[model samples]
Target: MTANREIDSILQRAADGGRITPEEALLLYTEAPFHALGEAADTVRRRRHPDGIVTYLIDRNINYTNVCVTACKFCAFFRAPKHKEGWSHPMEEILNRCGEAVDLGATQVMLQGGHHPDYGVEYYENLFSSVKQAYPQLAIHSIGPSEILHMAKVSGVSIEDAVLRIKAAGLDSIAGAGAEMLPDRPRKAIAPLKESGARWLEVMAVAHRNGLSSTATMMMGTGETHEERIEHIRMIRDVQDLAVERGYRDDAVETGQEIGGFRAFIPWTYQPENNHLKGRTQATTMEYLRFLAMSRLFFDNVSHLQASWLTTGKDVGQLSLHLGVDDLGSIMLEENVISSAGARHRSNLHELIWMIRTADRIPAQRDTLYKHLAVHYTPEDDPTDERVVSHFSSIAMPGGGAGRKQLPVVGVS
Candidate 1:
């Protein structure tokens, strides 16, 4: 069949509650009309989130260490093991950041960092225990499959054991980082030292089997083809389906819906600044919208589709709401890793309210667990007296202000 015919059929299947094969998905991604694609995806979004209101989370990302062993070429943040400026966040510093997040009304803290050589599961256990002890209200969402692989190897433990130990110490969920690319070719090109695609899925599968459902993410526009993009979605959907099947088998009394599955799927464009893939143009707004809409259509079982304003900018992020995204990721009281990679868009609480209202949707502040805390409708501008916060470099604190910023607290872009 022609690409157009294939896409139309696939879209019809999705609209009619039937699943499309991976090849059909690929064709739809390549040839589906933009308006039709958006409508189809929006239908799915409406089904999942019947309410017209979309949601965002109040959270912060705290990078625990910059010293990395798996130095990917696409990364601009990781420091070599022997680099003079290499460092890790001290326990006190981590605890302080969590406190700051809690003070700002953030209930989630993502403790992402490089794969440090010396750290073990014990390190995470102690850090998680301390964070939980300090702020029991905060959900400790940290680490990805890649970091898990490194930790498992370094600590001489199975992924299952590592997850159980971390959970015991209060790690709530995995962050799904290190997913630069899903296919082996692109994965090898960017982060060869990281675990293979299968291995990454294996670890996440273990986590899901152990009753911890986590979000999945895709990093796109890194010299991959449209077909490859569909494959990435297919891979995640396959895993999600497997997770559902596994859950049913694990418990005799528990129904599939009672067990944890893939909670959300987020796709963000690649940041092509100050990295080995320099000079390569990042994905365009149209491309991002296309991918976002396509992901919503293809991954029908995934609960939420997140718009990545942090990487795509405010206008594109807002536009994404119409293109079938049901959530705008987080407020991120603190976000450095992506900012360092050239995401210049900024937002405060006032701006976030204005954006959401202007788009004809209700803005809600939520916790990491998707529990709604507040629905914001006020359209007031930020107070002029609000102090400006620095962005790591200008932060003046203990440890001589190294890599600390003093940026203003704000909502997500």
Candidate 2:
């Protein structure tokens, strides 16, 4: 309860822009009164963004392939090499997907996929370059450290080389796609085949130094302990600190939006629907709310925090705004990875705006770097031209599509 001396002291300290220790964060996460904790986090949010505008991204998550070498137990989206469901989407389909994204008002595309054995750095070099050539307006925010590592190894090049080549090929930034859990226990339990947590941080550090910014992410409820969860954010906060010291640029110093390093921290609850783990463990709504509050208070240096409506559902996603979330990631014209794992929440442009409005926050469309593209302060100001991506569109679930086609698996609830 907030009446408790320790809770009151810690919450006030955090809300006042002071950093909380992992021990203090863990205590608050487990024992603080729900409303009081959320209110404190909201206070922090107000301090960071007094504008009271909630931002959303208009983007699609388009995968280029589904064949992956790392068989993470928690992933329901990957297929083994040459499996009947495995695919490397043709260049035409990739271009078509991007074209669709642009027509639907997308300013960015998250181009990610399985780490296919055959996809080296050159593969991405060509894919990214081709996409940029076709859609120069769409910012390409894609891939994580693991995928980059796989690509680098497959290409017989170093991590730095692979990153540099991709940047040249039009990778505007890196996506925090594969950062499931930063601590060793959860990473080992859920994604043993994936790269180490330390190495993951190293790759992001490399991206930051190379002038390619990225967001930090965590997938909770994958059977890790409470201490491990707190430790995960601690690890992220530490890396963020390191990134600022080593890679910070003053590109947007006037606006206080640091140009490089980790720009946002997005924590989403893991989907256990059809994965190997089989839903043995899950994070409750209560657990998730606590994480939202704790993360905002813990990451004073990170500029933004995002709520994952795609996985947590819209109601919880809306509730997150009061608990320190400033952003709802995207409408995601096409998403395969999490949807294949059982995330069914979908939104249209107007419905998403209404969600933000009903939450008593100004709804704004934002670019990749958190800049407001358009701020809708009143209903009349809302854009009527934006459209929605159907949840039951032509995309098919894994194995449901026609034979060996190189395309994405549409999520079926």
Candidate 3:
């Protein structure tokens, strides 16, 4: 354990807006008092967001295909190409899900899937163009460095060229879906077929340079050491520093306009169930909150930190609002990736607003760019839209019938 005075000194410096080093973060993550770490993180959160408003997004996850070539052992969502079980969502079904998202008041759609050997840039271009032509209102915040690299390799184009092509084809931004862990040891173990950590960061920088901002993510409890976890955050922060230096992002974004870098940092625990990991290791609730708080202190350059209710339970997600998180992520109207890996938590619109209000903060609906579109002030005024709910359907379901059009009721009593 760290000396009491030393930990206090570190927390005080961090809470006072002084940047803490990787060594200090490691000390706090492994040895500091749990509640004290949370308190320091809460102080920083309040300083950043003085308003008592917590934000959420009305979005859906649409996986176009499950046929993949880059087999990551940690993922239960992907099926090998040409396997009888592997299936791609027909274009009609993809568009139908978008129509459902529009009816449910979704502002963003996350399109990610397996790296099918047959899918090239043309496939994504056609998919994104069709989504845009049908629903121009929805921001196509889809895919990440992994998919980009796969598509580029298939099309024999450079990564930069691929990003630009997709942007023109209607991709507004990229999600942090594929960023499981950014360090070498853990990432290589989980995704040996995937790119290296440096290559992943290089692709994100490529996107930023092309004016497509994205969110950063880290998946904890994948057999990563405590020191390796800090390394992930440090790598992302270093890239953010480069973005600020190159004028891709401002030093401080007081206004809502974005200049194209990582807008938020979301760290979620790895769910090990049917996957190859087999639940041998997972992050406990205590570790998650500590790391969440530590991330808030470390990501001084990133703007938002989102709470992952779907992976962690709702109670912990709510507690995160006090610790460091300013956002509760999406209601995730339809999610199959993590669900396929044994993550079972789910929520709806009413529950989300109530979760925020009960935490003594107002709940606001934000767009993909972190711009507030609507804010719920009183319980009497919360939208009674039953359509904004998740079915908690996993990709491992019997078939591709996840009930997209059905509006499930969330009981308040």
Candidate 4:
């Protein structure tokens, strides 16, 4: 059979709700017609979600610490211990941030931070417990694999034990961070002291087995080849398969299904700003959208595909909703990690609803776990009632204060 015919057959099978092999996925990634692949993926997305109603989660990212040990080359946000600028937010301050998020209608708070030398399982337990105790309504969905590995060493606890303790402390779910590139060659080159690709998957598997569902992510366009990009997806797929297998064996959920597993797959491009890999090529908007669509097509087991509007701008993010992405990530009231890494794009709830409606998708406010809270068919349908008025202020950062203005809303051109 011709290569094109084989690719078509694979696409057909995937459309029919069947999983495609890695070889087939590679073909689609490499040779499948761009528009054809997009259309095929869109078909699958529409079938699963007939409304094409793209949604954005209501949450905020709170980077609790910038002091880090494993200084990955691609990171522009982390500061070494010796660096005077490196700092960690105290628990009170962190809780204050959570209170602010809750006030702004953020139901989930992403507690991201660098691997501080002194922080360990006890520190996280106290922090998570404190957050849960204060804001019982807010879900604590935070931490990446790198932090988990570092904390296990610092606390002198086994990986399984650390994860179990954290789960017990009220970690709602895990975020797939530090997955710069799943291929070992690039991963080792960037983050030498960090955990191996397999080890990262192992940490996540333990979390899944312990009844914690998390999202998977990939950081692309960071000097890795296109083939390596496909390999990243393949790696996540393999990890997800193993996670499901373990979850089923352990009966991680009461229903005995693959619950407490990977809930969504999110792929975003690398940001090169003040990092070591300066002057590196960044992922273009089209490349990002194409990859977003391919991700929806590739990760058959994953249900929700989230577009990183925080990394890519809102327009492409809006366009991505039609290209098979169902989630627009979070409406981050304040995000330092990515924004510090040169992601200048910003959005608020008003602008968020405008973007969603402009794309012809109903805007629904959702919680951390993707549970629907409210829907807005139009601005009139919005229930916020109290509009968040924009004002001028200055944000104090490690460098200096950058004045804030009203969030921009560029009309459709």
The lDDT leader among the candidates is 3
Better of 2 and 3 by lDDT: 3
Runs with alpha carbons beyond 4 Å of true place in candidate 4:
1-3, 246-258, 385-413
lDDT by residue (tens digit), candidate 3, 172-227: 98888788888888988999999988899999999998888889999988889999
lDDT of 2 by residue, 1-413 (tens): 46799999999999999999999999999999999899999999999899999999888777888899899998988999989988888999888878877877889988888999999999999999999999999999999999999999999999999999999999998988889997887899888888889899999888888888898899888789999998988888887787777747323433564456888888898888778998889999889989999999999778899998888888888999999999988877677788788876766677788889999999999988877899999999988764454342325343323222223323322
Minimal lDDT window, size 10, model 4: 387-396
| TM, every model | 0.89, 0.93, 0.95, 0.91
Across residues 1-413, which tens digit of lDDT does each residue of candidate 4 receive?
A: 23488878887777767888767776777677767777778778887677656677766577778899888888888899879998887888888767766766778888888999999999999989999999999988899778899899999999999999998998988998888787888888778878888788888888888778888888887777777888888888887787766653222333446446677888887878878888467777777777776777888777788888767777888888777877887766666776667776665667777777887788887766666677776678775623221111113223222134244534433
What ranges in model 2 sit over 4 Å off? 247-258, 390-413
Residue 336, candidate 4: Cα error in Å is 0.6
Writing each residue's lDDT as its tens digit, candidate 1 over 343-380 gives: 66666555665677788887777666565677765544
What is the clash count for each candidate, in the order shown? 10, 1, 0, 0
Candidate 1: misplaced stretches above 4 Å?
A: 1-6, 248-259, 377-413
Question: Candidates' lDDT values, in order?
Answer: 0.75, 0.84, 0.86, 0.76
Q: List the residue pairs that clash in candidate 4.
A: none
Candidate 4 Cα RMSD after full superposition onto the native fold (Å): 3.4
